[model samples]
Target: MSKVVLVTGGSSGIGKSICDHLSGQGFIVYGTSRNPDSLNTPELPYTLLKLDVVDEENAKQVVKSIVDREGKIDVLINNAGVGITGPVEETPNSEIQKAFNTNFFGPINLMKAAMPYMRDQRKGLIINITSIAGYMGLPYRGIYCATKGALALVSESMQLEAHEFGIDICNLAPGDFNTNIASGRYHAPILEDSAYSRNYEQVLYVVNKQMDDAEDPAQMGIVVEKIIRKKNRKMHYRVGAFMEKFSIRLKQILPDKVFNKLLLNHYKL
Candidate 1:
């Protein structure tokens, strides 16, 4: 039987590319989005479902439905997430709530729902798509980074526990990929007229500029496909050219204060 794989956030950007690649690789791929109707393309190689991972009940139901049809779940990719930028102090409670719900809680809920079937089968792969920001914090991205960092830590602990059930877990930390995430970036809500307003404007400027200058999404999609195909997958896979290398080496070669100062200066924070 073909291995059944479920990819959350599979409608666009990196998710769409991964879906396309996996379907081509002969997996019984199921891609999901909150609104499947928004995609105006012909039918894809894989099945597409309406999944809002943030909703715990919906997530559980979707996983059960997939298991009912497929008999076994082989791969679960927790790729659904949103980006929220701004200082922690200035960012609204609602925006922070949404960020944690989408980025952190969504994956946790899906993983909780998928584990039962995978444990029963005694074979599965769980890939959590995180960011380099998960490892290294950046100015104006405190909330987003915190969510990814939490994911990375959770996946780490999950790997140890899942292995007992014959399940393999990995975290994919991509530096920067060209994605609609930039175009779809949600501005942090400005709740009041205060000192935070000026800082918020600065953050908006930096984030918007970076979004305008991101890499192609297809490239990272290909990398994700490669990771899935590997027989001995590492605990973490960092994709992207220069950014990954620089992030790794900078931590080794530069002083902490020096590197942070450079980052602050570069972003004009």
Candidate 2:
């Protein structure tokens, strides 16, 4: 039987790309958008369902709907997330909590809801789409980095536990990808009078430019398909430019202060 796959945040960006690819490969794919009615793109290769991962009950309902219809969810792609940016001090507590709720807890809710069904089948795959930014604390994006970083760590523990039930949990972190994520992201107002305004503004420009020139979002689809086919799947995977992927390695080998210097120089802070 063809695998039944669920991809969150499927209205656009990486999630859309993944669903397109999987559907092309013959998987029964159900992509989720917070407001599927607004998309009105019935011609899509796969079905689009309504899901807002931040709502636990909504997440459960979506999962149940898939299982009820497909009989099993072979793969669950936790891709729905929000991007947040600002000086850590200037970023409000409410915004910070909201980012965590979406980027961190949201994925957990889906994983929790899907695991029981997956456990019953004793054969399933869960891919949590984290970020390469999670590998370190980039200036001005402290909150975003923290949220993705937290999810990466949490996914590791879940992967270990899932092994017992014949389920595979993996974290696939991507670097900057050409997508419409910039428009949807939360931006703490860049207060001109704030002390960090000049630096924040500079870095914000660089970040957006990176997104503009980044690799095609469709490339992520290819990577996701590759991960799905791997016979010896890894607990974690990364897909990005040479430098973006290298940055993670640099952080691993370089001293804290030296790596910090590299980041400062790169960001021109």
Candidate 3:
């Protein structure tokens, strides 16, 4: 029997690539978008389900609907996330809350909804698409980093807890991918008199340039496919650009002052 795979935020970018790649591998893939009817991506070969991960009730309904139709969900990929960029002090609580709602809590809700089914089956895979930013704070994107960092921590605990149930939870952190995330990031208002206004623009400019030069999203799809085929997968996997993938290792070995300086230099701070 084919495995039933669910991928959120599948209308485009990495999610779309993953869905297409998995479907091509013969898995029964179902991708979700807030408005499936509005998506015109005919080249994507997978079932389209309506889902808004930020809504707890809606998330449960979508999971239940998938279970009803597919009988079991073998894999759940939490690829849905949003980006927010700005100085932490200037970023409004509301904007932070919105980013958390979509990036952190959203994946948590979907996992909560799907775990029972996974536990019952005694075998499943849960992949949370985090970011290399989760490993450290970034200038003008601290909040975004915080959200992914929180999810990465939770995923660690989840791996231990779910192991007894024959379920695997992995945090897949990618550095920078050629996706539409840059254009979609929420920017905190920079008032004319704001102290960080000038710095914010420069930081945002660098961030955008890095994103523009990011690796292809298809690379993530290939990595995910390999992960899915593994009998015993690692709890954490880091993909993407060379420095971004190596940064995690560097952080562990380098002194705080040195690592911090390198980070600042990379972002031109």
Candidate 4:
């Protein structure tokens, strides 16, 4: 039987690309969308399931449905997440809570739900899609970075804990990718009235430019496929533009002040 795989936020962007690529590679891939029917695309190769990762009950049912039919879930990709943009001070508590629920807690719920089955099978893979920003806080995207960073740390702990169970976990942090993420990002409504308003346009411009020049999302799909096929997968993988991936290494060697300066310069802060 083909390996069974589950991917969240599979309606579009990197999630959809991964589903298509893995399905072509002969995996029994199932992709989740908040509203799968909205896609209405006839060409998709993988199965679509309705899921809202923020809803723990729904996540459990989805996994149960998969395991019921497939007998085993070989891989779980926690890719469903939302983006928020604004100064941390200006972002509403509700927005921050919402981000945490979807980006961090949602993955936690799925992991908890799948662990019993995976542990019983004594083997499974969980891939958490994090971000290069998770390594450092970005100016306008502080909340988004925090969410990803939290998930990355959780994934690290999970890997260590699940090792004995014959399970593997990977935190894949990609830099900017050409996706519709920008349009979907939640912007703080107070930006116009805040003191930072004067420079907000410049910040927004830089952010948009980065996305426009971002690497192809399909590249991530290729990288994920390779990782899936590997026998001993690494715990962490970074994929994206050269600088974005290199920045992680640079932070390791550069002095705190030097790295901070470079980061501020990169963002024109």
Candidate 5:
């Protein structure tokens, strides 16, 4: 039987690509939007479910609805996330909380909601869409890095915990991808009087340019398909341009000060 897949944030960007690809490949795909009714398009390759990942009860109900309808859910792609950028010192606490709620707690709640069904099935897969940014702290994006980094680590632990129950949890961190994330991301205002103003503005420009020139988000869909097909999967995977993937390795091997210097120079800080 083809796998029944549930993907969050499937209305656009990486999630849409994943949903379209999986549905085309014969998987029963259910993509999610916060307000599915508001979307004008009535036809898509896959079904769209209503979901607000931050809502705990909503998350649980979505899972139940899927299981109740399909009678089984073989895969859950925790692809819902938001981008946030700003100096750590100047960014508001509320904005930081919102980012964490969407990028961090949202994924956790979905996992919590879906795990019991997966445990009962004794065979399930979850692929978390993290980011290359998670591997290191970058200028003006410290909190964004922190949120993804925390999720990456938590996935590590969750995989271990879920293994005994016959479920596999994995993280797939993509580098810059051409997507709507750039437009949707929260960018803290560049205040002229703040100490971080000049540096923050410079770094933010670089970050935005990177997103503008990023490769296709469709590549992420391709990677997710490969992960789903694999029987023996790694605890984590990364997809990006050669240098983007290489940067993760550089962080693993480079001395702290040297790596920090490289980042500062790269961002022209």
Candidate 6:
């Protein structure tokens, strides 16, 4: 039987690419977005389902509906995420909540919702779209990084525990993808003359200046599709330019002080 694949946040960017890649691979693809009308899928072989991952009931209902129609879900890609950038102190509590809800809890809820069907079949693949931020902390992205860091741990624990059920969880760490995700970032609540104002300005300046230089999201789709199709997969896939590899390796090999120096110099801190 052809595999049934579902991608959350599939209306655009990396998620859309994943949906297209899997559909091309002959999987019956279904996609979910909070705003279903955001997608224009006249050409893609995908069915779009309305889902707001932060809503537990809504998340579960989407999974249940898919299972009801397909009889099984062979793959679930938790690709929905949002980026909120600012100095940690200046970012509002509501913004922090929004970040965690979409980035961390959203994926977790989806996993919980889909687990029953996967556990019943004793097989499944769960792919998480994490970031290099999870591996190493970045200045001004404290909340955003925290969400991905938590997700990294979540993915790790899930991999260890879910293997017995014949399930696999992979955390994909992509650096600087050329996606509208950055352009689509929710701006931090602005406060002029605040102590953190300068830092916030500096953060957004750095982010805005570099976002256009990020890698293409389609390549992310290709990498993910390969992992999904593989019989055995690694726990993590680190991707991006020379800078990304160097960053990940430096964080792994260098002492904190040394790595911090490089990071500061890289962003001219």
Best model number under lDDT: 5
Tens-place lDDT per residue, model 1, 1-269, is: 78898999998988988889888878889999999988798878889999999899999999999999989888999998898777687778988889889998999999999998999998889999999888878877888889999999999999998899988899998777778786555666665776677766776787677656667777766777777778888998887768655776786699999988877776787
Clashing pairs in 2: none
- TM-score of each predicted structure versus truth: 0.91, 0.98, 0.97, 0.97, 0.98, 0.94
Over 4 Å off in model 1, which ranges? 189-203
Please state the error at residue 174 of candidate 5 in Å. Answer: 0.4
CA displacement after TM-score superposition, residue 25 of candidate 3 (Å): 0.9
Cα RMSD to native, each candidate?
2.1, 0.9, 1.1, 1.2, 0.9, 1.6
Winner on lDDT between 4 and 6 is: 4
Estimate, for each residue in 146-169, the C-alpha lDDT of model 2 and write its tens digit: 999999999899888889999998
Task: Write the residue-wise lDDT of candidate 3 on 111-140 in tens digits.
Answer: 999999999999999999999999998888
Q: What Cα-based lDDT does every candidate model obtain?
A: 0.85, 0.92, 0.91, 0.90, 0.93, 0.87
Off by over 4 Å in 4: none
Which stretches in model 3 have alpha-carbon errors above 4 Å? none
Give candidate 6 misplaced runs (Cα > 4 Å). 38-43, 189-192
Better of 5 and 6 by TM-score: 5
Cα displacement (Å) at residue 76, model 4: 0.2
lDDT of 2 at 222: 89
Model 4 lDDT vs. the true structure?
Answer: 0.90
- Model 3: lDDT of residue 260: 91
